[model samples]
Target: MQKDEQRNIILAIVLSLAILLGFNFLTAPSEEELAAQRAAFEAEQAQLAEDANSGDPSTPQLDSTLSAIENAAAGLTAPLDRSEALDQTPRIAIRTPKLEGSISLRGGRIDDLTLSTFFETIQTDSPNITLLSPVGSLAPYYAEFGWISSDSSIAVPDSKTVWSSTVDTLTPSQPVTLFWENGSGLRFEREISVDENFLFSVKQRVINNGSSATELAPYSLISRTGTPELLGFYILHEGPIGVLDNSLVEVDYDDLQDEKLIQNRTTGGWLGITDQYWLTALIPDQEQSVQTRFVYTGKGNTTRYQTDYFYDPVAVSAGETVTFDSNVFLGAKEVTLIDDYQEELNITDFDLAVDFGWFYYITKPMFFALHWITGVVGNVGVAILILTLAIKIPLFPLANKSYASMAKMRKLTPKMTALRERFGDDKQKLNQEMMNLYRQEKVNPAAGCLPILIQIPIFFSLYKVLFVTLEMRQAPFFGWIQDLSAPDPTSIINGFGLLPWDVPELGILGFINLGVWPILMGLSMFLQQRLNPQPTDPVQAKVFMLMPFFFTFLLATFPAGLVIYWTWNNLLSIIQQALIMKKAGVPLGRQPDEA
Candidate 1:
């Protein structure tokens, strides 16, 4: 009977597979059709560009393409290469141990910078990760500091204003001081200082040279010319984020665009725009009060997102000078760096910039523990293994108890089967007998679920750590496993990148890019399942059998580090279950059912 039951289950699986394959075969698009669509789209874009250039209002209206949308968000009629845009502006060199770039002197903008330690790809010769670019660039993003005043008589330096720099390069020891006179009796001085890492100190000082006193409000702004490409997942926040009065506030770009503007008044706090891995923030003086605002200017495809703050107005009389001090943060979101800055600068809740998700309590600890382990072991992959063992050690006692109970339940399955047969149509009687049997045998069927329930939060927290932390960016794990925060580069298709051709990361089909780690995870889960007794219900058995396969596909696109954890965890569970089941003396075999 058991053999027959197995055969029937196998047949059902085969039928399901056949149906799935048939659907794929029917829906797959042909090469000709794909090429035709691409050609038509390109032709339409060319015509639109031609019409716009010729000033033809009668041109056919067209919906926006992704590139078009990005350009529109940037307030650019057309996208220009970033290098070209940066070349148009005069710049002062900025050099540090961890960063290399030139700050634009024309707008006094730190808009051309890249991380010295990070790269665009795994290749050693790849370019560094560009953090900011000039305004005329394809996707212009920058940070600027100046004064905003209600009084029109006072002239303040703006985006078009040109400043003369005393120094050629800004470094940790040498700061660049810029001078700009509005020709309206005001002499403006900006002294820009940078640390070896990513923090910039900008001191804005104004001297009222004219006879009348001037009231000007000092302000700092970090603006992204276009709506950036977002990860668009709920787990990650990629837009305007800030700490207002000790409270963390995060709003998506779409939300800000819809709401138009959000404002708050606080004595002091930090505000900024955060990408998945990078950040650009304006840190105001903690001792002084300021007005903060997150604003979005939406005009067609060209839009702008600005996170800005204004310090209380300063009244400077003739021959008197007032200074406004602030910090500009632009670089990779390194935890240790941010923590140091927070401590040194006393920025309130600055570390909250990294979205630890709702499970911050768990995720933060998980990251710190892993980070510590990595420091000790010197390899992130080995550290993950050690961390998994550390976590399992504490839960060992609970897991042992759960497995012992599961083994006992397997041993009692024979008696339970007999009760089911005896009570054929009497479901109530069968349940009663099963309960009495469980009580007598001291077997708790729910015991096995406790460990799994406890693991849910742990899994989510670890997943969050792997997904968002900069410490894990480009972290290597043995061969072919570079960049733990990214999806596995190798795929089952194309001979794991050995083939000359590439696979299309199509919408739903992207899930099929299973790597070596995810496959091992699926196999480990299957072996682990064998330690437990098969369910009496056929439907339940099928679910248990298919769970590993379902998870294999589902997690293929997740970060490689997260998938490695699951694989390692499954192997550990299998070993632990084996030991517990053997200790319980639960005989392993095909236990027969009553007929």
Candidate 2:
């Protein structure tokens, strides 16, 4: 009977693993689905090429040529390299503390930009992160603000129109004014000013000197050519995102492609496309009613994704001037900076762009705490350590009670063993005896699990903070941990880099490349487990003993920062449990006598 029960337990564990693996296999995209996606992408590309050559009336071309503007409405006839595209048009240089790029004079667009403070890699001379490329470049991404006129006879600034700039370069303290005039009595002037950070203040003024009242709407758009690469994680949102009507809206690139367009009318909000760590959004006037849209279009050999907004058309009377005030955010998604902008600019839920996950209440404050610690200590790794201690202090009373209960149970292990031996064959009687014993001893066997349960949400929140927040990216710790956001680099396969050769890539069995931090985490977990009460059943005890090893392999692929946190948290638990055991008069070295 015991052998049969053990076999059932083994079978149950096997079946559970099978179900998990089978679920993943069933949910994953099949080869046929991948092939179909490729075919669809190719078809889209072909249609775009055809539309470009056929002069599709719906396309929004950005070329300055009159024929191109009248025919194609999106972009250039052929794609050019970034440098070549920038050289094709005159530009006003933009120099800031954190950004270096140029504003395209041809379309009066903030097109070419690179994050001066961020690099593509951690190497000393790695290239800076390129944020926006020119319209004719391979991956054209840019922001443009202008006026749109409903009257067919009215001439407004199109992509083809070149505007003259008042300044040679745009800086923080110095603002640049761009001027353009229509042959009919209308003048457009855009004053662009940038702060030390990522915000761009755009004040667009339009004057009507004509002998008639003309109506026009102020509009701004952020356009990106081609679908950007995504991290492919469900936890992070990458694509078009906006806050409209006090609600956040996120649209995936694939979903947008299928839907084609998503439109909303809100009195105050912001709309834009977002990458994993970077953002480019348009903030329309907070008090004015605006029509916002997240649009995807395939034109020419490339596909373009755009988020734009247009204010209601205002009638500009003869000899009267009208102005529109708006802003653009283009740069890294820093936590504090985004929060500050959310309050200062009164942009609703602007901080949601950072992907703080479902536990925003916990995750945001956790990030702020870690950020504060990191600022003071100058090391994020150390900040994690400090934060762990800070978290432990508040939960001390609960943990102490749990440990005391575990200590009592540990002392009763011998009595449990005797009960099992006497009623070993009668499972029903054994359970009843165990309950009576627990009642007589004034001990709750389930008490030890409380600490583990409490750790679940805290664990997930910290994971979210380390995974999504930009502040945790590329943060260095001591001894070969250069990027806490990435998995540990020192794998056991290469003796933690003592040997020169490295392990070959293992797709599904990646945990085989166990790292030093994970091993330490497992060790710490084992020590903590030693302090807890042991299971009376032989099979259960063995399974419980193997849990630490199992979790070590399971979490080997997580970020190093998280592994460090777990290791530190386990060590703290071990110390707390040991102290509680001492106070309860339970021997720390006592082991359960299964015999």
lDDT for each residue of candidate 1 in 47-147, tens digit (9 for 90 to 100):
43333221110101112210111222223465457787677778999999999899898768888898998888888899889988776665567888887
Candidate 2 RMSD computed on C-alpha atoms after optimal superposition onto the true structure: 4.9
TM-score per candidate, in order? 0.86, 0.90
What is the C-alpha local distance difference test score of candidate 1?
0.75
Off by over 4 Å in 1: 1-80, 497-501, 589-595
Give me the displacement of residue 55 in model 2, in angstroms: 9.8
Distance from true location, Cα of 12 in model 1, Å: 24
User: What local lDDT score does residue 5 receive in model 1, on the 0 to 100 scale?
Assistant: 28
Candidate 2 local lDDT, 4-96, one digit each (tens): 323443454444334334422332344455556567667654554444323212223222221121334545676566898799889999999
Error of 2 at 459 (Å): 0.8
Tell me the TM-score of model 1: 0.86
lDDT over C-alpha atoms for residue 559 of model 2: 85
TM-score of 2: 0.90
